[model samples]
Target: MTNEMDNQLAGVGGAEPAGAPSRQEDRPAEIAPTAPEPDTASSERGKSSPEQHAEDAARTNDAYSRSFPSLSEGDVVQGVVVHIDREGVLVDVGTKSEGIIRRSELSRDTSIPAEEIVSVGEKIDVYVMEAENQDGNLILSKKRADFEKAWERVQEAKEHNRTITAMVTDRVKGGLVVDLGIRGFVPASHVGTGSMKNNLERYVGQSIPLKVIEVDKERRKVVLSNKLALEEDKAHRKAETVASLVPGQTRRGVVRRLTNYGAFVDLGGIDGLLHISEMSWTRINHPSEVLKEGQEIEVVILKLDLDAGRVSLSLRENQPDPWASVADRYHVGDLVTGVVSRLVPFGAFVRLEGGIEGIIPSSELSTKKGTKSGYGIAVDSEVEAKVVDVRPEERRLVLSLKQARREEEQRRERKDVEAYQTQSGGDELRYTIGDAFRAQQQSEEGTDQEEE
Candidate 1:
């Protein structure tokens, strides 16, 4: 860059503008007065010969060459911002004239204001667009310099496989556009983990990390991938999550999918198996009954096979065991009500609260006369029974339906006996004629109802 600057300076120093006459052609015209009343002093000064005027012009040009440094086009040089305005910016590139950076040259993005890109008195690097324009003004550009530097940076990153972050600017037909100080294109196939075909507008204005996959400076083309970066990050997190997992630890996860036997839970980065057997304390025929896709749940780590990258989780492990407190809740001779769950040849199983099932032997199904075998025990029927025994450690419970019925009958008989004693006033067997007549009338009414 320095050599180029020197070469341009050598060509222009002590020289006049190309095809511009050296005071000889302009002297005659200058001596001719523009106004009728030409000043006498100006005419006397114009009386000098063309040769003398040309010598003075050469001296002046030489002085200017010695005073100002030369600036060449295509050279990126350090500059200090001297002034800024809506129209353009003035930058001092160590030249006689402050270089003008047009609004267009400031940045490719037209929406950004000049004040935001560079402030007064701020030092920046600018690319020389022209040493001097037709208006004798030096032209500079900041965007061109940035573009060159950005390409170099992007190329280096691609070589080293480094990650970079840039803001998504817009959505194109085949991909997304990002401003990496240079235009960076992210193909649709590389937008994320999978080929994203929808909702791409949501990424506009978002800052996303990317990896430079291809770079071509000659054609000014750069290709990037957001999917590769995401996949890499996910794999890294999966490894860490797997290494940190341990049995019995609880974790929060989302149910991703449901299978016949189990559900797949996403534990942040990795997926773990949640078998149906561990979904609840009670039996379940399918995983859908216990979990739904996309539902969030808490589960305990049941096991891990790190070598195979497999994990097993349990939902019921986090729940309290129903049998744990059964002994404290149900005592001997206590009456409990439940629905008949299953009927078998030996007994009927009743589903108690908290998924506890208590069994009643067939002999205790009922004590009512004329009740046939298995007549009183039907699946899904509500029933009341007395708890005869409880073994929490062994998870066994015994219930008898006959005992509950017998107690109810005794309560009714005691009430009747008390009524008779109260009427007799002495526990003596006695009945008045009116009471006998009333009893006969009640028996006749019951017989009449049966005959009808």
Candidate 2:
């Protein structure tokens, strides 16, 4: 059986046709010399059979045909670091002799010591710079090998929209430089800091998640974005939140960021816009006036625009509605004080506490043309007025400045008359011959005051 197996193997390596091309040309040429095996001595002594001779011959053939792992100029292969010195690193790559990795080829970061980059007896992958240099030793580069591998990984991540971690290395002209095994750039707008003017130095040495936005093997360029990665993750979370969200539902949120128009609130997994107008019943110029970043608060969901992935939230909605109890606070003929918010051709709008506003018509502004309620008051000035009408349904209030002034004047007159009686022994003034003249003058004063 052993002799038959030997014959079968011999047939495979048998001589090709006389005119055919050399069979070894397309394959690796083995250079190791064949030597006689110990078993061949037994055959030569005439004590062994044909099977023993075939076995000896087969053993010699195996030695001659065996080859080292084939390597080329651009191939990457695993090797063990045999030595680390100031000159370079010696790596054994399954070769006749160890390969020579020069100082520049040790790592992408040239400043790193070879020993720091690699240690003796540690195995690493290296690029074949030249299979055989002038010295017949393999020229290898760890830098190039890492670069090639990084490009492949980046391309795959970009294609599949995968997130990868990169260590921030340095701050560059328009962005931050990161080590993604290869040098990668994260643009200022893509750093996820929300502003391009922010300092990027803080991110140095930090490992952050990134999404590859662009990759070019020819140029050896890679562009990544931490912002896009975060947004994409938020999108999925928002989709889930949107599924469970209902209008008028309450949610606990953190104030993530503030803008002139609104504050962005992070509600568990999603961010919702809390518009300035909806922050309070009273008007505010900016969201920061009421909310600060990192503040936690409860918010009400007002509306969701799924196509745009927009969420409308309200902080004021979660609280009591000032208008809901407007009638209970202000009644017709009740005197109130407020700031003059603005003036229009028809009237001036006054804003009371709790954000209630009432309009004073031009006609009702003054008891007469020269009265204090006349429409010349500057905006934001304090004014006293009487609530003439309250319309909670329309969220409108009608006030009369003239009535408030008239009532004030009448109260002062009554106080003066009561004081005079108190000084006169608590009895009403008597009309006499001398008093008749005073009585008639008083009657005329009363009529004129009433007419005014």
Candidate 3:
């Protein structure tokens, strides 16, 4: 049993196989133990390969590029102002880098600082001046964007015959500059309803309505007219006013213009001519004497010519007619005191009241000799006269200065005769001859004194 166990132990401990060489010297030359083959799969699992990393990086970059919008030069985009400085403004246009807008591209005023023109974080439209500049940044312009948008709106306005309101920025030679989102020019002739040859500057800083008359996109020129807009509005209003107007209708109006012949009153947009003759009951040399431009007044419509676009207004018709009741105020054989308004070759005109004049004929100037034909009556002098005839329809009043003086003399003579009779105590014939002789002598003396 022991021998068998020993043999088994030798076999388990790596004893040579049966029939193999028993001697140790018979073993082949021991070769150096070869290192086991490396486990390449386990090593490779420790970290990623360089090519795999490169593929991952490429994918990330492609996704980042797709996140941004495609852009091009001259394209308009909305951007937010990220930063503003003295030199320029930085805007984020959703690209890899923030876009840049130089100070000159912000506004027309180059001297203005960018910070003053734009605020940080404010979103505004921008025009891509350069999609990718040398620095790989978008170059943007605010002014150009505004100009492009403005032109589009302007063109639409012109096509639809629409009116637009714009702020007046500056006055230039022959025109004014207005901001209609873009610079628009209005010629002096089209500035206002009236001439603005020298008054265009008055509209600066004011917002006014205008009509787009002409637009040249290639030239970048736009022509506007405030006058044309006003005229169109006026014409519409005039049509309504003309339709409602009738002869003898009284209306309130504003004085618009004055001329040598008359004043033009704007009666609800319709211009009516108020002649100088119709301005007042009294005579006036000019319309300005009674009416002034821009004054509010009431007038009566005398006549209207719709086809001719003419309106005749009468200011005096709205007032009381002084001559209408002249006959009732004065009658024939009435004595009146008046001022000598004028002296002419034939007679003298005596003014009793406003627009009421009485003429003293040359034949009835005075009672005394050599005083005929109003030789002693001077203009503006006060005198008493008798009304010989009155024609209200003709506006005529004929007076006689001679009759007034003769009546006064007769009254004095009668008073003197009564006093003489009273003193004579009913003796009519006692002093008749003496009285007659005395009167004759007195008359002769008075005549001689008048001659002196």
lDDT of each: 0.85, 0.84, 0.86
Stretches of candidate 3 above 4 Å error?
1-69, 78-100, 112-124, 131-138, 157-215, 220-234, 252-261, 266-270, 292-296, 320-348, 351-364, 368-374, 378-452
Task: Give the lDDT of residue 392 in candidate 3.
Answer: 84
> Where does candidate 1 clash, by residue pair?
none
RMSD (Cα, Å) for all candidates, in order, is 18.0, 16.1, 10.3
Per-residue alpha-carbon lDDT of candidate 2 for residues 78-122, written as tens digits (9 for 90 to 100): 999999899999999987778999999988679988778999999
TM-score of each: 0.59, 0.54, 0.59
By lDDT, who's the top model here? 3
Cα lDDT for residue 313, candidate 1: 95
Clash count per candidate? 0, 0, 0
Q: What is the lDDT of residue 112 in candidate 2?
A: 88
Off by over 4 Å in 1: 1-71, 75-83, 90-99, 107-109, 112-126, 135-138, 166-191, 195-208, 217-221, 242-260, 266-269, 279-300, 315-322, 337-388, 396-452
Worst 10 residues of 1 by lDDT: 443-452
lDDT of 2: 0.84
Model 1, residue 67: displacement in angstroms? Answer: 10
Higher-ranked by lDDT: 2 or 3: 3
Better of 2 and 3 by TM-score: 3
Candidate 2 regions with alpha-carbon error over 4 angstroms:
1-160, 187-208, 213-231, 234-238, 251-277, 285-299, 304-313, 369-376, 424-452
